[model samples]
Target chain A: MGRRILFITTDQQRFDALGCNGGTVARTPVIDSLARDGINYTRAHPQNVVCMPSRSTMVTGQHVATHGVWMNGVALPEDAPSIALTLRQAGYRTALVGKAHFEPLLDPFLRFAENRMGRDGTHSEMFTMPDGSVVPHRGFDHMEFAGHGAAGNLHYVGWLRSEHPEVMGKFVPNLDGDLEVTTEPGGDTMAPQVRTTNDVPRGWYHTEWVADRTIAWLDSMGQDDDWFCWMSFPDPHHPWDPPQSELHRVDWRDLDLPAGYIADHEEREKVLASKPAHWMGWYDGSFVSNYEAPLKWVPATLQPDQVREINAMVHVKNELIDEAVGRVLASLRARGWDDDVDIVFTTDHGEMQGDFGLLFKGPYHVDSLMRLPLIWRPAKSAGIAPATVTAPVGHVSLAATFASIAGLPRPDYTEAPALPVNDDDARERGFERVLTEWDSVLFGKEVGVRTIFRDNWTCSAMLPGTLHDGTEGELYDHANDPLQRVNRWDDPSVRSLRDDMLADMWDHLPSVVSPRRTCDAPV
Target chain B: MAYIRRDIHIARTPAEVWGFLGEPARLHEWFPISGCRVEGTKRWIDLPTGITFEEDIHLVDNHQRRFVYSIVNNMLIKDHFGILDVVDDGHGHSIVTYSTQCTPNVLALVTAGAAGQGLAKAKRILEGGN
Candidate 1:
C-alpha cells in the first residue's frame, strides 16, 4: 500500500505559537516533535492571510487570483480543483473531518453546499452541484464542519445542540440577534469579542470533538487501505473562549508582551506611521477597511492588560489543540498507521495577537499575518532525514506535495512544485520567493495589497485605494528588523531593491479573474 | 444628511493637479468611475459595478480650482452633493479636498470611501506615478 497522509491545520495561529518555533508560552510537544523528526520550514507563508482565500489556495494548489477566492465572504467555485479530490481519484480513501472553510461560513439561505450539508446533516452523502457533477462533497468522501463559535450551520453546532444541549450556553454567542458576528465584550478588560469564561468541559469542547470525529472516521477504514485525512482545528481563531477548565494553563498576569508589540503608545504609533496610512487609520478608528475585524473595536483602545489576557487565551487554545493532536496521533499509533503516515502540520495564517497593539488581522502584509508555522514529517518508513528549510514556500505548493506523497503524477491544474526538503534542495529547485496578495471591498472601501518575500527582505506595495495611493509601500529587511518595526520603502538606499522586488511581484502575479466574484456575506 | 470631508496634500502645483480635475470628461482619470460623459452642465458616470449616475454640474471655476456636482437621478439616493477643491497651500504644494453629503446616511459612507480613493489617486498621478 502507498503512504498515508494526515494533514493538520489550525486557524489564525502564529508562527511562534509552538515550542519548536521559539514559542515559550505554549507547550506544543506533539507538533514540535514532528518538526524535530522531519522538515521544519522557517519562512513559509500563505498566498492570502485570511481564512477562506488561504484555505482555497491549500486545496486548489493555485494562487489567490487564479482561485478567485480573493477575500472572505466569496465562495470558492464549487468545481474548483482540489487535492483531496485528486487523492480520491487515485484510489485512496479521503475524509476531511474538521473546519472545511472552502466555502463561506456566512451562508444564511443555504446556497453553498458546505452550509447546506451542515444544515441538513448530510455530511456523509456525496453532493451534486447544479452542474450535475456528483463529487464527494468538495472531494472528501466524508466531511464534518466546525467553526469558531456556536453560530452558523456547522455540524459541530448541530451536534452540540442535539447530543449535549446543556453545554450550548457555554460558548460566546458568535452571531448576534441580527445574525452578524457578535462584537460583545465581557471579560476583565472589556476587550471586544473577548469572553473570559466558557464553562464547557474540556472533553466536549470543539477541539476534542474534532479529534474524536477524526478518530472515528479513521477507524472506519480498512487495515490495508491508503487514506488521506485532514484534521482541521478551529481553535485559536477568535472569540478566544477555550473551555474555562483549561484557563489555568497560562496566567495573563505572568506573561510577557509579544516581541512584535511596542509597549509604549507613542512608539507603537510611530512605528505604525512609518507604514501605510491604513495602519494608523485602523488604530485611531479613522477608517474601517475590512469586516473580518470587529468594527466597533479600535486598536488604540486596546489596553496592555487586555493584550496579556488575549495572549493567555490564545496560548490556552494552542495547548488544547496540541493535546488534541496528541490524542489523534495516539489513535494512529493504535492502528499502526503512525509510521506510515506522511504528516503535515500548519495553519491557514498567523494572527496579529497584539502585534503593534493591533488585535486582529486585515490587509497588513507583515510577518505577523503572512508567516506560517509549517512542518512536514515524512513517513518514518521512507527514511528522509530531518532538516530545517529556510527558503520561502507558500500554500500554493501543498497540493503538489500531497500528490507526491501519494506517488501520483502531479496534477496539471497544480501551480507550484512539491516543497523542498532542505535549504539546498530549495535552492536547487528555484523556490526563491513567495507571494501573497489581498483585495477587499468591504463597506464600499476597497483595498489592494501585494507582498513579496525574498532573500532577507519583505516588500509590500499598496495599490491605489481608499487608504493609500500606489506610491506608498513598505520595505523591511528581516535580517535587521525581524519585528518589522521600520519601513524603508521610500529610503534611497534600498530603492533599487524595492523597485526590483515590486517589479518581480507584478510580473509573477497571475491574471486576476475578471468580473471578480462578489461578496455575498460580510465574513 | 450625513456629511464627510477629506483632504490630502500633494507636493505639486494647484494648476498641475487641476489640469486633470478641471475637465468633466476626465472624471474617470482619478475617480473610481469606469467611464463618464458630459453634455454642457449635465453629466453621466458609470461605476465599475455597472451602476450609472446622472449628475448636474453646479459649478466649475478654474480660477478657484473648485468643481461641484450633485446626483440628480437614482432611487437609491435621496440627496447627493459632491465638491472637489484644489488650493495652493502657499508653500509650493496643493491641498486637495473632497466632500460628500447624502440623505440616506449610509450612501454617504459609500461616496466618502470613493472620494478618499479618488483623492489619493489624483495625488499619485500629479506627483508622478501612473
Candidate 2:
C-alpha cells in the first residue's frame, strides 16, 4: 500500500525563516520536530515566488511559465493533470483544504462551497461586481470574507474579521487590542472591529478553522487506505491580523525591517510608474518617489509605527500558524495516521510586506521572495526516512517526489525529472554533481528575467536575449556582500565565473516550451 | 508638511495636551499603522525601550487634553489636532473628544482609510483611562 502523504502549506512563508533554519524569533516547534526526526533539505525552491504562479507549479509540478497562470488575469488550463489527479488515480484519496491558489473557483473545486460565483469569478478576474470591495481574487476554496468593503475585488485573502473572533477558538480581553487583531480582516483591512463581538467567526474562517475541518476529514478517512492531503494557511500574509493574544505576542515595535524595505525615490518612481500589482492593494500607477509612498509599504523607511504594527502582525500570525500545525499533528497521532504518513510543509510564496519601499510582492528574483519554507517528515515507523535533501531542489520536483513516495512513476509529460529522495548520505554524496540551475523569472514568454543563486555567485540576465559573455548579464560574488546590496555587474575579476555561468544560462534556456517548466521555478 | 485628517476633534487643554502630545520618535505605540522598528534613530520600542514619535508642536489646548503635532518628515500629514474635555455629571465624570484632524497628501488620499483607524484607535487609547 502507498504511504499516505500529509502536505501542510502556509501562505507567504519564506524558506529560511524557522528556528531550525537560523531564524532567531520564529517559533516552529512542530516543524523543528519533523526536521529532527527526518530530512531537512536546505535547498528547496518554489516554482514561482508569487502566490498564483507558485501555487500552480505546486499543484501541477509545472513551472510558472508552463502553468500559464500569472498575476490576476491568467488562469490554469482545465485539462492540466494535477497532483491530486495523479494521486487519486493511484488510489491515494487526496483532499485539498485551504489556500491552494491554483484550484478553480468553478466546477469541481468550486463545488466545495456555497458562495461559488463570488469566489470563482473573483479569482479568474472575470467576476464583475460593481462597487463591491475592489480587492477581488481571494484564492481559497472556502472563503468567509470579513474586511472587504464593496469594491467587488477579492483584494485580500482574509476572513470576515467580524466573524474571525469566533473562529479563533480562543480569546483574552485583558490583552492589547492590537494583539487581539486577527489577520483575518475583522472588518476591513483598514477599519477594525468596533465591538470585539463582531470578531467572532461563523464557520467560514479559513485559517484555524480550516485546520479544524482538515483534521476532522483525516479522522473520517479509512486508516488502512492511503490518503494525500494539502493543508494551506492564508497567513502570516496580511492584514497582519490575528487573534489578540497571538497578534500581541510581537509588539509592532519588534518587527525587523526587510532589507529592501523601501527603494530609492528613483526606483520607487519607476515601479510606481509601472503600477506594480500588490496582494490586496496597489500603488497608484503614477510615478511615486520613495517619499510619496506610504510608510506602511516601505519597509526600508517604515514609519516607526508601521514597523511596530507589521511586526506585531507577522510575529503573531507565525505563532498562530505554528499552533495550527501542532493541532494537525496531534490529531494525526490520535487518528492513528501518524506512523503511516509523510507530512510535507511548505508555502505558496513570500510576502514583501514592506520591502524595497514597495507594498506588495514585486517582480524581483531576490532571495526574499524566492526562498520559501519547506520541510518533510516520514512516519517514524514507516522506515522510509531519507536525509534532508540539501541540493537545490525546485517545487516541480515535489510532484514527482510525491508520486515516487506513493510508489508511482514520474509522469511521462514533464520538463524536469523527479529529484531523488534517497537517504541523507546519498543526497550529500550527490550534492556537488547534482543538476543545479535557477530558471530566469519569466515576465511571460516575452521578457527575460534575471536568475541568481549558488554558494556566493549571482547572475542577472536582461532577458529575451543575452549571455553573461558580453551578450548582457550581471554577476556578483555575494560571498563578501550578502545583502547583494552591492552590484559587481561591472567588476572585472569574476569574468571567468560569469563566462561559465553565462554559458550555463544559454544552455539552460529551453528553445521552446518544454511542456515541463512550472511557474518559472520557485525558492 | 501637508497630510489629511478626514475627521476633526477640538479639545480645551491644548497646552497640557502638548505636554503629552504624541511624538514621532516613539510612533509605533499610538498609531495603528506604525508597529515595530528594528534599526534607526527612531527605532522600534519594547518593554525596555518604548515607542515614541516627536511631534512639531503645531497647536495646543491646555484646559482640555488636546494638541496638534507633526512628525519630522511630514508630507502625508497636513494638520492634526484633537479636542477633548472631561465632564462631571454630579455622580461621576465622562470625557468627550474629537480626534485626527490631519489632511492626507495625494498618495494618502487613496489609501488613507488606514488612517481612519488611527482616529478610532486614538480616541479609545486616550479616553479609556487605562
Give the per-residue lDDT digits (tens) of candidate 1, residues A1-523. Answer: 9999999999999999999999999999999999999999999999999999999999999999999998887788878888998999899999897898876675433446787788777766566666677887678898888888777688998998898888888788875643445678767777777777888888889999899999999999999999999999998998888888888899999999888888999899999999999888889978878877666677898888888889999999999999999999999999998889999999999989999999789999989999899999999988888999999999899999999999988889888999998899999999989999999876557889999999889999999998777899999999999999989998998999999999988988899988676555566
Best candidate (score: DockQ): 1
TM-score of 2: 0.59
Instruction: For candidate 2, give the docking quality class from DockQ.
Output: incorrect
Backbone atom clashes (below 3 Å) for every candidate:
0, 120
Number of the predicted model whose lDDT against the real structure is largest: 1
TM-scores for the candidates:
0.80, 0.59
Q: What is the interface RMSD of each candidate, in Å?
A: 10.3, 18.9
Off by over 4 Å in 2: A70-72, A103-205, A255-301, A353-359, A382-386, A419-448, A464-474, A511-523, B1-130
Looking at candidate 1, what is the lDDT of residue A37? 98
True contacts kept of 2: 0.00
Residues A244-266 of candidate 2: C-alpha lDDT, one tens digit per residue: 43443655555566555543655
